[model samples]
Target: MFKDRTEAGRLLAERLKKYRNDPGIVLAVPRGGVPLAYFVAKELGYPIELILTKKIGHPTNKEYAIGAANLSDYFIIHPGAVSEDYIQQELFVIRTRLKEMYKKFMGNKTPENIAGKTVIIIDDGMATGNTMLGTLNLIRQGQPGKIIIGVPVSSKEAVEMLSKEVNEVVVLLSPEAFYGVGAFYEDFKQISDEEVIFYLSQLQKPS
Candidate 1:
């Protein structure tokens, strides 16, 4: 078990030391991933950017994710599982929120281009990997030279699911009897938008 997201990020950064100073950018899955990604970016001397994406939850059971969507693109793991109307509605709502988040955190700055550059995607943890699968599909459109996923802990299923898609999956723990992401952390707290802004601001400061 890790102490918190900060420690988890530091350890993940240690494993990713070979990529330090490489022509790569860190894409953090907010708002939980920001803190962890901040530490990793600091350790690797890379710029940090937010990869804004949210899961498209099933209509019947909102907790179950059928796919994921960003502002421009989306991925559906189970195409016929949900209705077209539902997907469209979810996409609109999710994109609207993502736009607000992007504006809030980045102000008027444009997103970084990842073409021909190594892209390291960081998150607190993965559960079913459905959401991440959706994220990967969108990231692929950017034509990155290589894609890597860094997480502190994940379920065995999540690791297996993501391993086949990305160039590499760096994980600290993949327990067979997997529990939710927060269960492994002693100080797991919901990250607020204010905290997200703070971390991003810190990343922008001169070293």
Candidate 2:
């Protein structure tokens, strides 16, 4: 078990030492991932950017992710699982919210180009990995030189599912019993938007 997200981030940064100062970008999954990514990005000497993607939940079961979408692209695991109308509607709503989030966190700054550069995606943990699969599809559109997933803890199934899609999966813990992500942490408090902004701002400061 981790003392908290800070400890997890430091440990993850150590594991990623080989990539220190590599020409790459560190993408955080927002909120929870920002803290971890801050440490990792600082250690690796890479810029930190948010990967703004949200899951398109199944109609009946909103908790079950049918796909994931960003502003420019989307990917559905089960093509015929949902109707085109529903997908379009979700696209509008999700993109609208994403635009707002981007504006809030990034203001008018242009997003960094990831093409031909190593892309390391970081999150606090992974559960089912469906959302992450969708995220991978979106990231591929950028044609990064490599794709890596870094997480503090994850279920065995999640690691297995995600490993196939990315060049590498760096996970600190994968317990066989497989409890939820928060279970592995002594303090897993929900990260707030202000905290996210705080971390991002710190990265923007002159070193």
Candidate 3:
């Protein structure tokens, strides 16, 4: 279908060009979102930063995220990911790891910077959307003026669910036969920490 994630990101950037001169920031979910959000940030002229969070995977299946956790003083946990018993047991470990991530990436900065500002949250795509939902909930407490969730492609269910959560939602494709986020792209390799560091370093924030 599409040549690769870069081309798809360019196309998605074109659609979001109107935000270039507007007051906004593109908060990207790291790893996969960096490439797509990098292009969008380059085109949109908004600074891009990682919305750091972790998937609270099932007790056994680590890859399968039953819920998600966003740590920055306060953490938003998803209920469906596990039961209360599991959460009570696992919260400390997740928090400790997240703090380590915060120190390594964000340098223990306060997460209140996005307050009262327009935030454009970008991701490569959305599937179950529980992760993003927790993201929204976590940031909403910071009192952003408006939240716009953007993605290049998503399933019908994800699009529908996300639309009701944010002020504006942009989705480029919602194929009925959606299998998974990786299926649409030719290169779905995991994005490395070095790449994330490189892009964030290169992005120039308007003063």
The candidate that wins on lDDT is 2
By lDDT, the better pick of 2 and 3 is 2
As a TM-score, model 3 comes out at 0.84
Residue pairs with backbone overlap in model 1: none
**lDDT agreement with native, every candidate:** 0.91, 0.94, 0.76
Q: Write the per-residue lDDT of candidate 3 for residues 1-207, one digit (tens) a residue.
A: 455678777888888887777777888887788788888888988777778767666788766666566654334354455567777566667778777766765665555377777788888889988778767777887788889888888988988888898887888888999988888888887888777777776774444
TM per prediction: 0.96, 0.98, 0.84
Candidate 2 segments exceeding 4 Å error: none
Candidate 2 global TM-score: 0.98
What tens-digit string does per-residue lDDT give for candidate 1 at 10-43? 9999998788867889999988899999988888
Rank ordering of all candidates by TM-score, starting from the highest:
2, 1, 3
The weakest ten consecutive residues by lDDT in model 2 span 14-23
C-alpha RMSD by candidate, in order:
1.1, 0.7, 2.9
lDDT of 2 by residue, 127-204 (tens): 999999999999999999999999999999999988999899999999999879999999999999999999999999
* Higher-scoring candidate on TM-score, 1 or 2: 2
Lowest summed lDDT across 10 adjacent residues in model 3 is found at: 72-81
Clashes of each: 0, 0, 2
lDDT of 3 at 201: 69
